[model samples]
Target chain A: MGLPKKGPTLLKKKKMEDDEEEIADLSPEVSDSEPESEPELESESELEDEDLKLAEPSKNAIYNTDGIIDKLGDISFPDNVGWIHRLSVDIDQEQEVDVNDDLARELAFYNQALEGTRKAFEKLQAMGLPFLRPSDYYAEMVKTDSHMEKVKGRLLAEKRRIEEAEERKKTREAKKLAKEVQAQKAKERAKQKKEGIESVKKWRKQRQQSGFAKDDDGGKEMDFSFEDGKAFERSGKKRPGVMPGDRSGGKMRQGGGKGKSQKKREFRNSKFGFGGRKGLKKQSTAEATNDFRDFKKGNVSGNKKRKR
Target chain B: MGKKRKHSETVASAPAKKDAPERPQRTILGWKDKNNTNNNEAQVTESTVGFKNKEKDNKVESKESKGATLNELVELKSCSSCLFFECRKQKDLYLWMAKCPNGPSVKFLVNAVHTMEELKLTGNHLQGSRPILTFSSNFDKNAHWKLLKEMITQIFGVPKEHRKSKPYHDHVFVFSIVDDHIWFRNYQISVPHNESIKIARGGLENSTLIEVGPRFCLNPIKIFGGSFGGPTLYENPFYISPNQIRAIEKKKKAGKYAKKVKAKTRRKVHELSNPLEPDEFADMWKE
Candidate 1:
């Protein structure tokens, strides 16, 4: 105080003190950094009790956690044999907590069913109903969406294949019905065609019988007749080219083509009673239909010949 | 016609069951063992032990399946005594009763038919002091603890509230094996204040434990090799009934009394013949 304190001002002295403090704080940070980096140099033998204790509260939970996390899942339950055994196995297997609630619930139900079934079987044994055995739950399970669904899937696939085959068979039956309908239609069409052809032959024969013999020759364009005398004899009859008696004999009255030796066609020899010339030429067993044309049909007022 | 057929079937089945054993041999039980405990040699054949040991080996050979695992069989075989065995097959409603030759006069009938709902197989947990069935190495190795408990509860169910009026009417049976004999005990698991244990309500240790027994001894009538039902291997002849024991005791008492009366009358006659002769020398009844 007698020397510097008396001469120096108070504010200047305070400033000088603050500068010294700042330098003191800054110098050690730089100097001690190297030693601090060598953390391994903190020898165990030299370790003090103060260093051992947790000195930093900020580092307690966030930076240096002592694993309070597992306690979050803690569920307190009585230590019974069943639960203890279950937990022991679970712990041994080290399974993670299941998030799928449905699976866990189903498994619980399965365990219960299994337990009850086993108990019932045991009871039956005790009751001396020894022949009885527990039914196979696994077999039943395979038919459902259980662990054995793979078997069910294969069985379903086989069932589907059988169903598809049955469907194909149904379609084939429908096709067969359609083919039968087509065959019936063809039979009706052939019958109609035969009736039309018969009418044309009858019209030609009528023209010859109605004293239009020369015109009949023009219609056929050929004369294979050998019995010129019979043709002249037929000239007086109302039906000139046909005789009443010959109608029942030959299916057709062979007015022309006499002695030409045309092969005889027997209608009875045909399988379907058709396909022979003799079949179409049968004399009217029952009269032809009312739609028959008159003998004068298509014979112009006076017969006119076709241009050569 | 159906009734007649059913009756005929029953009659047919009864004889079939009776004839089913390897041989017509009944089980015999004895309180005392005939074999010397320290024979320290090869086993004494069952015949020497007074068992109808015929076809034992043959029956063992005849069993189709290999039989239960040795561990499972051990517990069953070690049950040396059984008070009775009643069988009620699945088809039959009524049970067939076969009381053990040496069994308690009183018994609780164990009926089996129950529904899934009545079984209450779920939501059950170990509570209070449950009956513990202690079996020897036989049960230890082969025992599945959970399965065993479920089976026990089903076989020995606790009576309902109304039926609890009589204590002995229902019981939980604990089966244990000691020295190759199955020691069966019946206990009622209830609060200690309910009487029986006689612990004075005093000792803290004794009051908490709820076990009570070694009450009944069921000498093994027969030890079949299989669980549920199996082929009989041995038939012992020593099983004595309680009535027989009582009758034998009465006969011995009557014989002793008759002898005493005859001795008294003979002594009176002997005294007239030779008054100086000692009582030990008195044999006038012989004359």
Candidate 2:
């Protein structure tokens, strides 16, 4: 019955062997010499590098035409094609990857596609079907691939240039408009001066006709004895005429004869009452004249006598 | 230290202990008697019969002195009767509240009222009292004079022709209605050429002195005879008639009167006329 006092030790040995087998299956490649390096550790490090590469698609190999086609399918175009075209036009023509050639090909293809799409859209519209989705249209027109980066850069620069040119044009227009306004004002001032000179000449003529010397100082006193004698001869009484030291008329002419003329017109109109009604002007003028005569004679006795 | 602390405590409590009064007080007997007498007098004065009798007598005396019967007095209401009457009453006094169309609201105490002629006759009566018709508060004395002149023109219905007089001394006028008697006074405001009695005498002679007081108050039957205790109407002094304006313009033209020049240097001769354009003259006349 005691046939095997070794049964207990054998059982313990078998359990240990099973545990070794399970460990080998779980981590088969791990060697005792590198016990700290697990399979999970190796794969995790490899995944980190992959993640880094995936982070920036434009900077990595995935931004290429093949990568873009693999990720987003065909029809990936750059949105800045116009700028790309302009840059190509400026660059050396001998270059193999001529941006202008690419742009022309792209533009022709886009035009054709746009025409076909528009026709299809019209047909769909007639059938009452939704035609183009804005997102899809932009996706087709914009290239997200790294191969189209130069085209996008060119487009952005051209946009800025166009805006700057527009601003310069607006500035030039403003300056031109301001110059025109200044010239107009200068012309008006010259006209006003001419008118003033003409009025002064007419005033001088009038003064000369009234028996005053043309070259005499307007403010100077003149010897009226001679003129008084002639006036007295004409009508036993002193005649009313332009007197020396009278600068009011001259000032009016220099400033603007229009004011005086306007005043005279207003006075005449008021006297005759001709503005609205008929015959009123004549009647009023006559009455005013009579009243004026009476006032002169009355003043000689009324106010002057009292003062004496 | 213990002794000092004890002393401080005593000092703090001393006032309270000292406030105990010697005895309680009672009202004096004279006080009661004085109060009783005052009450009796008040009661006696409060009797309706006695009060009515005294009030009637006072009213009768006031009416006779004012030359107004009780019924006539009642009929002569306050300025509330006039369409232009705009005033407020405080207690027994009626203040002249000016609702000026061209000025800020002004409240003035009704100082006095004088007839136009009376104001012109009594020159010294308004000396102590500020001139009632003066616009000098808002404007200058010259402006006041112009306003007074306008008022006179409007009241007399006279044309602006008489404005040519250079020495317009007797132009300032005011009117007052006090009791039964209406007194006429004339005041002459003149800018003296020289401080001489002869000049003063001449100014007085040439000045207009109208006596408009006695004529109205003397005859009670007349509308203005009885004292009408209300606002007085004044003629606008600045108002000028068309004929007068025309006359002024004619004189201005014929005389060739130069405008008053504002120069530091004095001119040898002075022209006494206004020099305005024909149109300007017309404009002034039209106004």
Candidate 3:
């Protein structure tokens, strides 16, 4: 056992000297470029985070091609070793992947694995080997039962979280749709009211042309209530007992007080104290000040500038 | 019953031994600091969990005063290949893979380690089933990459018909080189199967892969021509030591206040050299 080991070590020692000489020849060429490379690496240091690499390959780095090939020859298994024994498959990567991009890098790795496995499975199938475990085959697993349980629980939680997010998104969309529908219904109602008014106007014109009734006819007067299209609007004239800002349509005045004295008091209150702010009534509004019909021209100091 | 079980066990193992290729025994030895027991132990155990039958782990103390060096100890054990994990500074885990009794060994700085105990990776397979190794084509692009690939294949691949290995192949090992680092991932191949030994029809199309845990990326630092100590064959010119990186970061931070002070003085000097002239209407608004 010792003798076999000694023989290889002796041969390797002899090869090392020749490899060193080749490195020596390469060292001078490497040294000339070494100073130029250091500054370049310094500039790249800030660009890289956890895993730092030089901007470019250093020219002086040792590469013993023959020695490495010899070592490979020495260490690799003999040619008779079958593919089944190795079970290694090499897959081609189509493009260069940027290391900083986590998603693309991981995708490349995943694709490599997937493609390799496909090729490997085909080879296994051709050889008639047992690739898949039977359904009933029970054995020890790499992870424990307790561990698998945890993994299952985590997967279920992730699925539930995603489902909840989807539900929230769906409800938000539904609310938006409902609001749009409500707005559409209100617009339809407005259109219907406009159409009803237009049709009534048309009918009234037709009736007048056909000589349905005279203007003084009491039975036809009820149909004339909305003839002007101002049937729902309050009249502009002020009533004797009603306040200016009464929202109750003067019903309060009609409902209150039955005696003559109470009616007088109510009328007095309506004129002076019942409703409306006195301060605003005393101030001159824009319309009131602009009304020249209320001014007496003779009483005005017309020649004050000339007199001074 | 015990005697009958033992006889059957031997009978089951006998044919497997005959069918397996002649391979030298592989050993896993690690010397870890006392403070790093938990992480290193979990790493070693999880690594052995895949090929537990073929691998025997020995916990050597960090003290190296013993008569035999690592290579000598491995040679004495008659192991052809050895994986030695050396933990330094209670944090950095350096993995040394050496072919014993001769030359050619690789030292890698292991980073981004996640053990099998993590719950996120849900895949599981038979404990001792042989795993199919798959390598990215870029591994053959360089001489060093090629050598490392062979080393990884030999060390990680379970010998066919290993006594402790199960007959079925239910998992795959992915070794892909990205950014000059070897990334390792183990995935369980779950194919819908029938009662027969073969997969169901269209099972391959429907098959999916789930990741098992114990993921690590290896950055090769040096390749020695000898087992443990030898003339260096290849050196990565782009490789920067972690210590140097840390020191550079510290220097950058230390320059912050000094840089501010220097800038302030320079600005003051610039103002004095280019003093402004008084305006003619400076007192025009004064009474």
Error of 3 at B187 (Å): 1.4
Better of 1 and 3 by DockQ: 3
lDDT of 2 by residue, B162-181 (tens): 12111111222222121111
**Mind giving the per-residue lDDT tens digits that candidate 3 earns over A105-214?**
65676667677777878888788777778777898888789888997897788789999999999999999999999999999767766866776787778778868766
Best by DockQ: 3
Which ranges of candidate 1 are over 4 A from the true structure?
A: A1-308, B1-132, B136-173, B178-181, B186-207, B212-215, B224-231, B236-238, B272-287
By lDDT, the better pick of 1 and 3 is 3
lDDT of 1 by residue, A1-308 (tens): 00001111111223333333333343444334535654543331122110011111112122111111111111111233232111111001122212123244223322332233233324433544321111221211101234224434554676799899999999999999999999999997677567555655767677668767667456663332322333224334465555566754443666345544433343343544555577566755545645466555666756466522
Superposed on all Cα atoms, the candidates' RMSDs to the truth, in angstroms, are: 44.6, 57.0, 16.2
After TM-score superposition, the amount by which residue A186's alpha carbon in candidate 1 deviates from its true location, in angstroms, is 99
Q: Model 1 TM-score? A: 0.20
Error of 1 at B157 (Å): 9.1
- Return the DockQ of model 1: 0.01
Show the colliding residue pairs in model 3: B104-B225
Sorted on DockQ, highest at the top, how do the candidates line up? 3, 1, 2
- Where does candidate 3 stray beyond 4 Å? A1-50, A202-308, B1-41, B48-50, B54-59, B63-68, B72-77, B193-203
Model number with the top lDDT: 3
TM-score, candidate 3, is 0.70
> What would the per-residue lDDT of candidate 3 be over residues B177-269, giving only the tens digit for each residue?
876788787777775444344454333765677777567778888888888778888888767666655565566568789999999999999
